[model samples]
Target: TQLLEQSPQFLSIQEGENLTVYCNSSSVFSSLQWYRQEPGEGPVLLVTVVTGGEVKKLKRLTFQFGDARKDSSLHITAAQPGDTGLYLCAGRDTGGFKTIFGAGTRLFVKA
Candidate 1:
């Protein structure tokens, strides 16, 4: 079965910090998606990198896909209290419409 596992299930940092989260799996994926969720709201798509070795950035956040398409990472620079939220990584199987999500990384940026 294809699965995505995320590291650092929880994170707490003072405002203006930096951190990196990892997502890994033994199974290859056709596409991978990253999301950020705030309390009581559905996750919002942060970015999606399809090709192996692909990299994308949004503001202070950077995302990278493994060359083998089996892993990914997210890096945040100067994280603020507003950046505090749940980070999720999801992988889509090539053969179907199913998407599997990682356990998630919960971040807390103290003011």
Candidate 2:
């Protein structure tokens, strides 16, 4: 079994501050996905990276996949209060249908 570990399990910062969260794993994955979940809601898909070294941006958020497809990172620029939530990273196994998820990073942005 593979595991995904995320760093800085919790974070609190003033609004407009920039932050980066990391997700890492020892196993290589075919694809990786990032999601965000607010209180009382399921996680919402933010982005999916299929190719190694691929980078995607959504507004003030940026997502990147490691060159070896074994890790990923999420960077938020000028993070706002609305960005407060739980950030999750999931990776699909290269030769199986199983997907492993990280422990998750909880972010709180104070206004």
Candidate 3:
């Protein structure tokens, strides 16, 4: 089984600040996804990267998939208080639908 490790388990920043969180794994994944979960709620899918070296942007957030498909990152620009949540990275192996999830990075954006 592949295990994903997320860095900087917690982050706290003021509104309008920029921050980047990382997710890494030794094993390669066929696809990876990012999600954000607010208190008392399940995580919400943010984006999925299926191709190596692929970069995708959603508004002020940028998602990048490493060339080897073993790592990924998420950068949020000018983060707002509304952005505070637990960020999770999940990856699926090439042979199965089972997804491995990182411990998650808890972000607190203060207004």
Q: Would you estimate the TM-scores of all the predictions?
A: 0.96, 0.98, 0.98
In terms of TM-score, how similar is model 1 to the real structure? 0.96
| Candidate 3 runs further than 4 Å off | none
Q: What lDDT score belongs to each candidate, Candidate 1 first?
A: 0.95, 0.96, 0.97
Tens-digit lDDT string for candidate 1 (1-111): 787899999999998889999999999889899999999999999999899999999999999999999999999999999999999999998885899999999999999
Worst 10 residues of 3 by lDDT: 92-101
| Per-residue C-alpha lDDT of model 3 across residues 1-111, encoded as one tens digit per residue | 699999889999999999999999999999999999999999999999999999999999999999999999999999999999999999999886789899999999999
Counted clashes in each candidate structure: 0, 0, 0
Q: What's the distance in Å from true for residue 8, model 2? A: 0.9
lDDT of 1 at 108: 97
lDDT-wise, the better of 2 and 3 is: 3
List the candidate 1 regions with Cα displacement exceeding 4 Å: none
Model 1, 20: alpha-carbon shift in Å? 0.2
